[model samples]
Target chain A: MAELDEIIHQPLRLRIMAALHALPASTGLEFARLKKLTGATDGNLGAHIETLARAGYVAVDKAFVGKKPQTTVTATAAGRGAFARHVATLQEIIAGKQP
Target chain B: MIDSQQASAALNDINDVVHRVRQSRIYQNASLIIVMWGALVFVGYLANYTWPPQGYTIWAVVDLIGIAGSIAIAAFSGIGPGAGAYALRLLVAFLLFIAFGIFCSAVLGHFGPRQMLVFWPLFTMLFYALAGLWFGYAFIVIALCSSALIVTAYFYAGPALLLWMAVVHGGALILGGLWMRRI
Candidate 1:
């Protein structure tokens, strides 16, 4: 059985990764939007996002949208691949098929 | 560091996130396009009924214009990649349907723009049904109503047909938009 990705195994990061993975690669959710989706406080979410970024799992684009700050977070190709493997590993564990 | 129990919990969390993503605003913008085209086509059909000779040309021009507007809206909507890709596919399919109809009209040499009344709503409603199933419930109602309208249009002649199209297609779009907004 494949080992779980330590980076994606955390509860909050897992939710973020899953949400991003559900979207197409070229698309991303804004920071505020992702916070709502994951039910994370701004500081907590920012820290975890920073962690994921440091690990090269996601790409963060910070720009001005009509004056206000907009941070769009998209899952990189590597991030998506890692998330897929992690989910598959979870499934294996649930199915009792991990070998 | 996640064992089986935590792994199960994590899986559940993933489901929740996925559900939230689906519920995001990325897909809501599709309703605006639906309403726009719906209103446009209704006006076009209404113009046709009001002016007989000029109605066909007006409807054709309006239809093309609506397609162009939809393309622009889809381009700038900031919708997710999946919905964006599906919109592109839908456009290609719509164009092919139109092309096939034109070819048939050319071959028959003076029947009618059967594609407009007959195939247009049929294809539109089919996509609506699919989108409704994927997106929300309002679309399903629109799909059924449009299907009924198309059937009714098939029997009606000339001005009456356009009237039905206006009422049914346009009505569904506006109503669907309103319903989606409530959701």
Candidate 2:
């Protein structure tokens, strides 16, 4: 049986990863949009995103759109793989194939 | 180790977030299209009001631009593979819809200029409302509000009906598109 990813197991991080995974590969969500989707405050979302970034689960791109700074987050290939496996393991658990 | 119940809850949460993301993407693409149409119709109405005799020419130009712009947006929106097929399908659907409208207004009903003015907006809004049954509530709200204003102007705006439509129909769509982006 597979184990749940401790890094992704946190509720907010789980939500974050799920949002990124839903998009087409390499497409990123802006920080404001991600925060709105996940219902996280700026600081809280920033910290969780940092954690994901460190885990190599997501790539963060910072750029200037005109004079304004913009941040976009996308799931890396490894991140998408880990998220898929995590979900499958969860499904297995629900199906009584795991403890 | 988490139990089945805990795992189920986690999966449900994931599903919820995934749904939100999908809806957001839809809103993003739709908002652009709506805004483009709104601007086009705004100008179309003003031009029609100014050149009453050339109303047909002005509107034909406006509609052609709107359709072309919408197709361009769909193609460039990064909808992934089959985007060209999707665009072709969209153009076909639009042609069919317009054909049906022409059949109803010109061949079957013989609607006059005033009736034609109101008919097209109402007819399009009806489709928007129907699409909302699948797309989201924002479309329904925009359609309903715009239709109401158009109907009101049809009865009450007198000689200024076109101007009223420019403000109400065109402005409502522009505002609604902006609002959809926030949602």
Best by lDDT: 2
- Compute the lDDT of residue B2 as modeled in candidate 1: 56
Pairs in steric clash, model 1: none
Worst 10 residues of 1 chain A by lDDT: A90-99
Off by over 4 Å in 1: A41-43, A97-99, B19-29, B42-53, B67-130, B138-183
| lDDT tens digits, residue span A1-99, model 1 | 489898899889999999999986768888988998899999999999999999999999999989999999999999999999999999888887763
Interface RMSD, candidates in the order listed: 2.3, 0.8
TM-score (chain B only), all candidates: 0.74, 0.97
Top-DockQ candidate index: 2
lDDT of 2 by residue, B1-183 (tens): 899999999999999999999888888888999999999999999999999999999999999999999899888887678678978988998899899999999999999999999999999999889989998999999999999999999999999999999999899989989999999
lDDT per residue as tens, model 1, B55-162: 568967986887777777776666555547866876896698677656655565444655456566676687778877877667778788778877877776554787
Q: TM-scores for all candidates?
A: 0.61, 0.98
Q: Over the full model, what C-alpha lDDT does candidate 2 score relative to the true structure?
A: 0.94
Query: Top model by TM-score, which number?
Result: 2
